[model samples]
Target: MGIHLHKLALVGAIALGAFGLAACGSGSSDSEGGATGVENPTPVGGSWEKGNFLPVSTFTDRCVSPRSGTDPITGSAYADVLGTRQDENNWLRSMSNELYLWYDEIEDKDPARFDSSLTYFEELRTFALTPSGREKDRFHFTEPTNEWLSQSESGIYIGYGVQWALISSEPPRKALVAYLDQEDSSLPDAITRGAEVISVDGVDLANGSDVDTLNEGMWPAKSGESHEFKILPLGASDPVTVTLVSAEVESDPVQHVKVETTDSDRKVGYMLFNDHIAKAEGELIDAITELESEGIDDLILDLRYNGGGYLDIAAELAYMIAGDNSVGQSFEHMQFNDQHPEINPVTGAPLDPTPFHTSALGLADDSLKGYPLPTLNLPRLFVLTSGNTCSASEAIINGLRGVDVEVIQIGETTCGKPYGFYPLDNCGTTYFTIQFSGANAKGFGEYSDGFVPNGPFGTEADLPGCEVDDDFDHLLGDVNEARFAAALNYIEGGDCGDVAVKAFAEFGTSNRLLESNVSVPKEISRSNRIMVR
Candidate 1:
């Protein structure tokens, strides 16, 4: 779940480690009262005071060092790693330490010198490998402990292994701040900002109050570019120094507005869903409702950025789309660890004897039916896809496709991570991927690269004449009825040509291939499994 990272105690993680301390064993005095008879004093736990975090109005909005990727297949594109500055690595290492993980020994065969980000990533790897059952309480995962161990051993980045903690010990006035510094010469300036508070009185950001109280003015962007967010102490002198950890830019919004001058008769709804988080789903529905009111019909559901989240949200949205069809169909099914029970990974105590299982939309009793929505024999539905669309997102796309939904896909591929995660907290670290099995509709559970989009993954639909309504964009007291009319006409059946496609493509669906050059794996099944829950 991409959004789940922010929802996880991420802000808390930033704040709990907000205070910087000198190295622990560096000859610090821990004298009770008078100096110890011994010469150098032993270091004690790191100390933090009530530090104030201020808003950063001035930022070094420069570019960042370039990132290098290798061609795992041919090794032809191997290049030395960039962005290896000591400060950058230092930041990542600091974050890793905050995660309570350590750096595993680096390989002599490392592609390049150990930079900060890589160093931090290495620390995470180490923690994943040599987890001292004692420190496992820091991280959180949705997968069961056994599954996590298995996947971790395989060394994949399927489920995000995020950890959460508290930021302040005081009566809740502490804030966690993040800064976006894009001052490297290698890459373009791509950092942006947004804000969300986790608690007014020990509440979580997902509960709604925290986000409502967040001061949105703290971070500004370059014109239309998007930025991430973080909260800080009331008055921290250096706001830029406190970096807010976030996912990539492509994974933020669930919906976008694209308008152009084309007159294509097709009115498509391009909706990007990057996670199954309920809050984000709610936002997505609200956006769709708004669009519907504005007169939009045909839609493109973009799951390219989704990583997965609460399964219930996925089911609900599917039901809304399916309408009455969900009544008899099984959209998706989940599996649980009903097998060998080990000592509870968390407490080392006996675990619950029974495991839990549910459909993607959960279950239905005789009293209440589940997902009672009928399928809208809607128009062709194009699902813009990519390698990042994972888990529940994959489930929805794969399931819907089984039911003869005109699920046109335009994307490279989907991330082959379909198992559900059951959260397990042990000691202080939270263990994810603990227990989960494959979740598919009826016949679609083969793992490999989940769901390869059929046909060419082309750019989004191009429709013209859908510019921002003049009434909304103009300051004139008179309404721009013509602008509204144009929007309406385009939604009904007007073609905008390439300009329309280009506008929609800006939302990141242009790169998907109609067909992949790479060969599909045999392990990845093509059978359709449509489930209705």
Candidate 2:
């Protein structure tokens, strides 16, 4: 929603004040922050430059673009915010109300115009109070106000607290500008004063030769001549200096395979996926291609470290893996300005500006569908999952599972963020919403309830001696355990009864899989049961 003309005039000043409030105490304050009333100094703004803001014309041109260039995966419900609307005035009104409420909560000290910022507490009231009252409760709007109030409050209270503590002075009407002055980068310089430094040689691990390297280490940063730094520990509990005679720099040494051929010829592949896909995608594709060429039979995609980014690339990769099964299967669909579609009501002209709307994979002819990759036709797959696998990566898992590929999930349950979002750049900031819910085999969306693994995999606690993150490794590798023996037996062309018997011998009769599989009465002990039972 665009800002209302009535509100736009005051937005700039209000924004500056809000920034001031948010910047206090931390931009330069002590790490633990001194007792509230300590005299403090201002922060020194670093030489680092801010990025350029996208021009308003950029949005205008996009709004007029007939190509439908919005992200397809984000779905269509957001189309209302992206396209022109007949009720343009009403949309602006809602946007203005939200902005006013925000400004009032953070910067408006005049209590006459409104109640406490906390007054906008009740979900029923805050969301329900929108001018239209129509979009109320459409989206959950339950962000806690306490934290926002603390973070957004004018630093006046804290600044006064500090001064009073130091000099027993009264609380000043305004925040002591001395402590929060950010025009010059002074505070950071103070915090980092007297940090230690050392010198070391840089040598390549692959070739035992000294090499010139870029040395960009974390603070206590100082202005000094560049030197080859062997190891720079910025915030280690105990900083140790080591002179570098030989340095080791190599690519992340995680590999994937299509099958665990060394162990009973079970087809399996390994993948150690990370969130920063830009640095890993090229190598990831090469690794996958290598596995296919090697005639491996199964796969294990390890995504424990994947945080998420550039979902388009993730989508493209999913198409490579499961595209054939997922094509025509809808991932998510969006609706552009669903409520009122045409000329503006205020001016009786073209909708001044259009906003987009979005939704999940509902039954609609034009619903944007996901194109899945062709199946690998493997009997079973092992997936090394963890909390870090989120966003685009989760989409891949969800898309693949929707195709009925039996995934033996390992490690911890993955981060449950199945809803999709497109960066909705409005004003000077970006707000992302749950624009679309990802659908499964039956076109049922999966956002709130996440994908649970098949069996108990990794524990929350880290194992001793093993790399802490290797819980993901254990999940992927532990499939050779008795827990998976039953699934493996079935895969090896055994009867379901035999597989169940094998699973029972290893995991015991009271095991969950055995209980779930058996329907007949417990007539005989396991030793006397038929092998094929």
Per-model C-alpha lDDT, please? 0.32, 0.30
| Model 1 C-alpha lDDT per residue in residues 1-533, reported as the tens digit of each score | 11111111222223311111111110111112122233322222222122221111111000023213432212344221222233232332333333321212221122113432222333433322211132221122222222222222222221111111112212332222211111121212222111223333233333333332222212211223232333333223332222333222211235453322325544444444544543344455455555455444455565544556555556556654544444456565444333213332222334332111122222222222232322333534545454445566666665554444545444435555545543322111122322233443445554433454332323212111222211211211111222223223434444211222111111111111121211111000011111111
For model 1, give the 10-residue run with minimal summed lDDT.
520-529
- Cα-based lDDT at residue 311, candidate 2: 45
For model 1, what is the alpha-carbon lDDT of residue 499? 22
- For 1-533, candidate 2 gives per-residue lDDT tens digits of 11111111111212200001111011111121232233332212212122222222222211111222342223332231222211121222223223222212222122112222122122112233323233322221112222212211111111111000011011111111111111222222211211222322343212322212211221001233233332223233443444222211122313433345534675555555543222234444466567666666666566554545444445445544543454555432221122223432122334221111111111111232232222344544555444444555566665555565455554445445544333222211222223334444445443332345542333211111111122111222344432233334434543111211111100111111112211111101100100000
List TM-score per model, in order: 0.38, 0.39
Q: What is the overall TM-score of model 2 with all chains considered together?
A: 0.39
